[model samples]
Target: MKMKKLLISIVILVLLGIASIYIPIPGYMVITPGEMLNTKEMIQVDQGTKSKGDYYITSFEQGPANAISYLFSFTGIIKVEPMPPLDEQKMDVEKGKADLENSKLSAMTAAIRKAGKDVKYEHKGWEVLKDDTKYGIKKGDLLQAIDGISLKSSEEFFLPDLIKYYEKKKVGDTVTYQILRGEETLEVKTKLVEQNGQKIDDLNLRLSVKQKAEFQSPVKVNFKKLDLGGPSAGLMMTLDILDELLPEDLTKGNKIAGTGTISADGKVGIIGGENYKVLSTIDTGVKVFFCPKENAKLAQETVKKYDIKVKVVPVATLDEAVEYLRNMK
Candidate 1:
């Protein structure tokens, strides 16, 4: 009887262990190391050159935490955080897609301009910068018109006209906005409010609406649609495009990987999850990693913490990145 009782206890423990693997912890997310992708295979430029070495982009995996992952979060192997609201998560997914599209365009424009080619841009529409308004205007909505006035004109004149229209109205005024949300077109009504002791004007409008850039360049650049989203790959994508445009190889025959958002004017912006990204580079044979200047300290710390062999280089602009590669031995 004693032996039978011991066997039953062992069976119960095994069942509980198995159940833990599938059980999910609510309101929590887990982040883990993701893959390193070669940018050469992801981006293609027509009539572009090739590089002897490869440029890679690193990413992190994040999702709802399982029971095991929730427990492992205490050990520092993974990260666990409160999951964002479902509505916020949906909006983030949309914004991530938009950011990725803008990143590709910025990468192409920056590379082409760097190659001494002409590139011009027009403001397509206004992108919603905030969703705090009560007019049903959510973040990521594209505002095409205000009070029946189209904001799609020349970038120089659009803001002036928009400001002029708003100047005629006082606080507590009602205005209609024509916006595009995915495949649906909706008109939203919002009340004008005073900002900084002044009625809402172009300056106030600019706070909530950012002009979307549409580039026209002589050189055509296209990216293979991947399951990836977000602007963190912008810097690496720009470098890869430049490598294909210039005669000299940017990689210097060494494997390079990086993360940072690139602007149309070549500025590099900070990105999140630098520590996890550093871990992703381990065992990947990446010789150097470039990140935004702001993230450099944290990235270096992570590298040191993990004892990674990769060098962390911080850059403020696309030009700085290019210059660094040019001077690499």
Candidate 2:
């Protein structure tokens, strides 16, 4: 009888321990180093040349935190943060997907133009980021027009245009918006608010609907279906596209890794998780890692903190990265 009771107690403890590892604790997320993917395998440019060298994009894993992961955060190898509200999380996921799509488009345009080619773009519509106004506007709604003004135009939408449209109007002015939700087209009314001597509303049209791009060059670029979704790989993808389009070998037969968001005009934007990305390159034979100039300090600090054996190069533009590779010893 004594032996059976002891065995039962041990089993209960074991089951509890396993449960703690698998069950996620709400309101927190765990972030850890992820993978480094070679862009050569991920991107294919038709009518473009293949290079002997390789370009890698770094990534990090994030998910709801479990009890075991929360405990592991103390070791400094991982990070845990309080999760935002559920609605915000959903909005963030949509934004992330949109950003990934935009990144690919921007990379292709930037690379093609840098190679002396032309590319055209059309603004499709506006993506609703917030719907906190008194109106019934909901997040993820496709904003088609405002006060009969079509959002879909040849020119890109800018904040100044939005401001200018509402400039003559005073606070408490109401505007009608035509939005598309699924297959349904609905009209919603929103009221403007005063902020810093400017009249604005929470229509949240800043996040543009995905733009359509047409490349004039014979070279066509397509990305393989990737599990990751974010804009941080934009810079690396642009570099890889350039490598494929140009006759010159940008990699110089060396393994290079990087992370940063690339704009259509070739500017490199800042990204999160630079430190963990640096840690992910350990023992990967990556000679050089490029990051946005804004992240350079933290990336270099992470390299020093972990004694990583890679050089960290900070670049503000695609031209800077190209010039550095051209002059690389």
Candidate 3:
């Protein structure tokens, strides 16, 4: 009878463990340091733009976590964040990837233009790239406005700017969108909905860049990462493109890493997680890490806190980075 009780207890304990692992928790996500990926392994520039040396971009892995997994974080140094409901998170993830692809194209345009070559852009209307059945927004319709806000098409509207306006909006507000279908523009209004612990757009639409770039002499670039999202990789990607176009290598025989948002004007904008990136450099075989001028303080603090051997170089523009590398003895 004692052995029978012992076996039953073991079965019960196993079931309990399984339940703990599968149970979902509310309002939290797990964020951990991701790997330092080398850009050379993933980026392909046309032979006209190909250069020498390696560059790395850093990322932090983040996703939804269960109660048991969240609790396990206390045992180590993983970060837990109270995210928007699960459905909202899913939508944001989808939107983030689309925005990232647009940003990468913008980065390529900036890099090729910076090489003193002529670049051309084509205006592709906000063609229905993503179909949302709820708002009667069909595939192939061109988006023209949102809630009376006219989206500019100078370079075929910055898609993220339009998306940000909606994402920051109140959870239950109604939004009116103007879309063009079959040569006629129409007003379509939709309301956001919250249910089952999630709130998502009633007019769930996926939009992308309508602007395609053409460069004289054609220095085409392709950036591929299945799991990568966001525009943080912009600066390194721009730099990599520029490096390949020039005869000299900017990496200068040392491993380099950086994170920043790149603008079409060649400016390096601030990005999040500079502290975490600084910490990532320790024993990672990197000698120099470049960051935006705005993130210099945080990078310095993290470096000093951990006594990392890497040098933190702050640059404001692509030209500054190139000149610094050129003059380096």
Candidate 4:
């Protein structure tokens, strides 16, 4: 009887182990599809636009091999590009390279203070481009100050108040502002044109924050500071930045699973960690997988081999992602 009982116990243990293979552990979040970015996002400047004699700290290099540089930097990978010094022609051109819309709008209503014309203009915003500018605004000549208020950091201004007040006027309503340009300060007035036939609710206030970086050029990645420890965190970091800035609720409070690098223009770039990240997220029962377009292919193959049931989507930008999340509800 003792021998029979021991054999039965062994058989029961084997069966339990086999059953565990089919059962999935619970996960923490759900993922959905949006866009597919092709490369890892980093910051780089146009050498033609940049001239010698300006103070610049080489913020990032190019490619996965350069991850070490950021590990030792002051802001880690978060502030990859160092602040560059300003010269006359070079400063004007660099400022122009920022978001065109923001520059145009700001030039009309605000005047940035400076010690002199030689002072480098800089501002703190929620999302700054790599080359350093407000994410959505552009650069232009200033004519006046809006509502007698001076513009400081692009990110700190109150936008809703401006929009609400502007709405009361007709298309040709004249608005006056105190303006400064190239060592001269004067009053300038322009007619406000009513923008119609679009669903634009409010002026993108977040666009004025000028500290965001521009990722048009490739900067090197120093990966030691990343908690995820791979290129996958890049895209997620970009999304996190977007979620932090606008009130649109991009993530909708869901757990977002993605892989890519954050670019200065808010574009998602490609990176490694697809297979590993997929497996890790799968084991936790993740609802969605955000990865590169190329890596998504690998993930699909892995899914077929392992018989995965979860959803995996590739993305290219934060805008696409916001749309995807919005449709899920």
Candidate 5:
């Protein structure tokens, strides 16, 4: 009887250990936006579309352990709000091919350099209202200041942080702006409205000033929704842009997978979560996995250790991925 009881206790302990991985331990459940925010300027912007502004996204950090914590964190919460599909709703991903093509590193760097010298704010893009009347603001338009204060790149200006600081103010509270338009310095006044919606305040309104802005005048935009797990979508975002810029289709309907952070210039950078992503692709029977040059070398080394039937297409930039995809087609 004693031996049988000991075996039962051991099995229970093993089960508990497995369960603990998913259940957030006492210390790890709550994650703040600050934890995920990248303090540096390493982020993508959509310069070619009506929707513009500065935004960044962190990759979804999930595993058996994270998966459980995510579940528990949202256990009793109910969402009545309807959201757009992953590709459509999330500004983090590229909107379409045009956005990717327009967001090239050269273009962005040029904008930033000019803004640094002559303007207080500069970003490749900004969003327009539903009526398409005007953009949030244009590039090269001097953003004299936010909330009646002068701004310099020296001041890390983020919309969410501003709102949080000013949240105590009422709806009619005025956020004064001094704008520079061309050779003329203009003054514009905007009033604060009550915050609505279910998402965090920081994510809802992303504001920035710009010297000037350029966007495609709205050609026929074909959009297909995709399920992208993280920032790795940057590479795919650029390739999709090249496809629109070029004469041919890159994704000829075959399942393609890969991960990397891509610049508008096409340089692919290392992204997070390679191993789990590789495993996901393998399990999903993906045909081609495109990885950044750095990640590709590591992934290749890993693939050789395990028998992976999927073809791994290694690319250094968005152009390379586009070329590979075209060849596959």
Candidate 6:
């Protein structure tokens, strides 16, 4: 009788522990390593398309987790969100994200066009809309600053810089911004708030910045929607597009995976979930994983932590990535 009781108790505890991972704490979100999307297959470049080697985009699978997985997240192997992510903060989360995705595809198209032909991609700033926009920011205005810092015209790309400033701020804080409408720059201020312990942008306006791409030999690039949001895939998309547009096989017959947000000038910006993406890339038989130089320390740490056998290459710009792949032997 005593042995049977002990076994039953153990079983009960085990089941309860397993159940903990899925338990939804109100307002909290879960983040886990997501799978690899062989993005090359998803993108169709109009001119020349060839399957030389694999080029992939990786994302982190996010959702509620079990107790075991929850505890493991603390080891830095996985991430958990304390707040509703930016894309999900609004009711039109999918719509907002889709618009952003379109911008990324546009950016990629511009990058490739500039490499192969003469082209310039231009976007002044994200237009501010009144509907559902937080912080009382009016419509038809351009966001030019955050926290009183001006996103000067001389600054490279406003989107990435705009994102960087907002991310540095926490909930319950006050944020001030400079908006541009025509020739006037006006200051707007708002208070920050938290959703499930994650700080959200005070201004929740869906941004579809006005962009114009100029190219003589325009490449009509179409990206298949895989329900993935975020600009992290920009670099890979640019490289893959270049691979197709250029005669030389950029992959050099080896699988390559990368994560970064690309600017019009081809500068690669930092991205989240590099470690998670790298881990998934490792499983995909990729010979090289490109990481943004801006996150050099994290990339180096991830490589050192896992003692990753796969070559981890750090790149600063789209041209740098192209040059490295071009020289691959």
Best by lDDT: 2
Q: Which segments of candidate 3 are over 4 A away from where they belong?
A: 1-27, 48-52, 66-77, 122-128, 131-217, 224-226
Model 4 per-residue lDDT at 307: 61
lDDT of 3 at 13: 100
The numbered model that scores best in TM-score is: 6
- Which regions of candidate 5 are displaced past 4 Å? 1-23, 28-60, 63-213, 217-230, 241-247
lDDT per residue for candidate 2 within 257-296, as digits (tens), equals: 9999887778887777898898899999998999988789
lDDT of 1 by residue, 1-329 (tens): 99999999999999999997877788888898788989888998899987989998988898988988877887665798888788667656766776677678778888888988889976677677777454566878887777888866533222434555766888778887778999898887767776434455322333344558767888888789867777799899999998899978888899999999886778887677888887899987899999988789989998988799999999988999888888888
Answer with 2 or 3, whichever has the higher lDDT: 2
Clashing pairs in 2: none
As a whole number from 0 to 100, the lDDT of residue 144 in candidate 2 is 81
Global lDDT scores for all candidate models: 0.79, 0.80, 0.70, 0.39, 0.44, 0.67
What TM-score do all the candidates reach, one by one?
0.75, 0.75, 0.68, 0.33, 0.41, 0.76
Better of 1 and 5 by TM-score: 1
135-176 per-residue lDDT for model 3 (tens digits): 666767776777766653523243344445756777778888
lDDT for each residue of candidate 4 in 1-329, tens digit (9 for 90 to 100): 99999999999999988766444333211122223221112212122121111110001122211233344333222222322233423543433343333322222111111001121334423332322142222343332346564443332232334555766656656665554444665554555653322112122211122333122212221112221122234444444333333345554445556565433333445554355455544444445667656557877675666566657777765456556766855
lDDT of 2 at 123: 52
Error of 4 at 90 (Å): 37
Candidate 3: C-alpha lDDT: 0.70
The ten-residue window of minimal lDDT in model 5 covers: 31-40
In model 3, the clashing pairs are 50-244, 51-244
The predictions' CA RMSDs to the true structure, in order, are 8.1, 6.7, 5.6, 22.4, 14.6, 4.8
Enumerate residue pairs that collide in model 1. none
Which should have the higher TM-score, number 3 or number 4?
A: 3
**Per-residue lDDT of model 5, residues 202-228, tens digit only:** 212333222233333122333333333
Q: Which ten residues in a row have the lowest lDDT in candidate 3?
A: 205-214
